[model samples]
Target: MAGPGVSRRRMLGWMAAAGAAGVTGASVVGTRLATAVPAAEVVTRQEIRTLTPDQRTRFFNAVKTLHDNNAANNQYNRFVLTHYNFRSQGHGVAAFLPWHRKFLRLFEAALQRIDPTVVLPYWDWTLDSQRPERSEVLSSAYFGGNGTGSNRCVTNGAFAGWQVRYPNLHCLQRQYSGGSTIGSWYSPGMIENVLNTNRQSYDQFRRAIEGSPHASVHVNIGGDMSQMYSPNDPLDWVNHAFVDLLWAEWQARNPNLANTYNGGGAASSNILAPFGVTVASTLDTRALGYTYPRWSGSSRPA
Candidate 1:
């Protein structure tokens, strides 16, 4: 890893050189670094369930603080609007993964600004694929359960009765696809298969993951989550964090294909709007100052 103050371009150049020189070793993202980047600077995003009680409290508190701001120009609403405005360019395209990767980093930064100790936690829906409604994530103790009444306003959890402004003023809501229960999600085995099948192609991998498992979570969750302004629901952050983790895992598994971005004529130089960062720059998660917990075999880190 490169030392502090190393530019992303310089680090990427070093990585390219290391690859060309056939350098290899055990490292956080499965790719050995040719230079030193501080380990402490790279925070590991843990699974939501793995977070301690205090950590959960801090995370939720920071999120609620942003929610409470509720100003038209608030950072939280800025994120929701950004996602809504860029929906066409960000979704169903080769840039989907990279776009969300950058977006999540920005959202996480906002939360961290309020509480530096908080790192975005991911919801590993694979763990709840069997009975999503019964998952602890939806319990009142965490994100709260389904919305009640005709309006479908969220009446529980950290964001209950939260009002949002995008297209109009409305309360945050959720209507599970299966009435009172959310339908089953993709299994760990299915994700493992996705990782294996699209090992060499970024486009194929993006398509497979985005079209199926990724979309399933949003669709099943329904209401605000399914709309263009999905970011209105705080679950969007954790859910996308999980999606980004899967992409990172795929990249780590295929070290030689680290910068293998393609499809839709999307070059590594193409800029991800709103951030002004190139696709190539977002390729390495560690270079962007974060990584998911290291894991082995077919299972994700708990």
Candidate 2:
């Protein structure tokens, strides 16, 4: 892993070299060089399409391994339940950011347990707003295509014919709004406006981002993605990662309000359950030991 000072071009070069050398199975120690990128400090979450083919394969393989390992028990069931069970407290409130941060962290930890090389990559939906169907992230080589048939079951992508055993017994499903087509995605301009909010509190910023592109993406995805069990579709994690990235960016930009908390009124602080993390704990990416590829004020695409 490169140091925090390493250039983005260098980082991509390293990843490309790893992929070209067929070092997907290489140990973490083998990937690091002397006096440069630290052995234990190589963690980075990137845009999904930015990942090399090998990296993508490793990611999907780990997810599939966990899925098959807990076939009868259903690994995704617990996560989906956790979200729905706390729906009232988690969404449209101050807990929304902290709760999702913890949720994604846990899921990312589970992925790392299976494949140490896999860091959770996010899907920047804004980039796909112009022509979503043409986006490589949704290609057959990746997440597959839109759903078909009565149940709107997804029959393509890496997770084709996948079974989701949460809430009910069923095949993994998706119902694209326009037959085999996807709707217009959230624009980068909208995200820029949301992030540029001069709000004095976390909820003010949270409500703006959540109201537009955030909720818009969920509803646009439809089917399982529109429900509590949205995790059934792997895209849910990727989407949430982007959302969390935005929140983190908002925090970084407004240092004065970074520690501000108004969660659950005076009775309760900004404490998020399960992980028991406060909103402040979720503010710094370094404190969480991970960073997005483009977080440090370069979040907007030029």
RMSD of each: 13.3, 13.4
Put down candidate 2 lDDT per residue, 14-60, tens digits, no spaces: 22321232112112111111111122674778888888889999999
> Candidate 1 deviates by what RMSD?
13.3
**Tens digit per residue, CA lDDT, model 1, 1-302:** 22222233433432232123211211111111112223358899999989999999999999888767667666677777667666666886788899888888777777877887998999988888878999899988889888889989898877778988765778888998789988777778877877888876888888788765777677678777877678889999999999998888888888888788884555567987767778987888888779997543355545
Candidate 2, superposed: residue stretches over 4 Å from native: 1-42, 69-72, 265-269, 295-302
**Per-model TM-score versus the true fold:** 0.84, 0.80
Worst 10 residues of 2 by lDDT: 28-37
User: What does the lDDT read for residue 190 in candidate 2?
Assistant: 56
lDDT for model 2 comes to: 0.67
Residue 286 shift from truth in candidate 1, angstroms: 0.9
In candidate 2, residue 228 scores what lDDT?
Answer: 57
Tell me the whole-model lDDT of each prediction, alpha carbons only. 0.75, 0.67
Q: Model 2, residue 275: what's the lDDT? A: 55
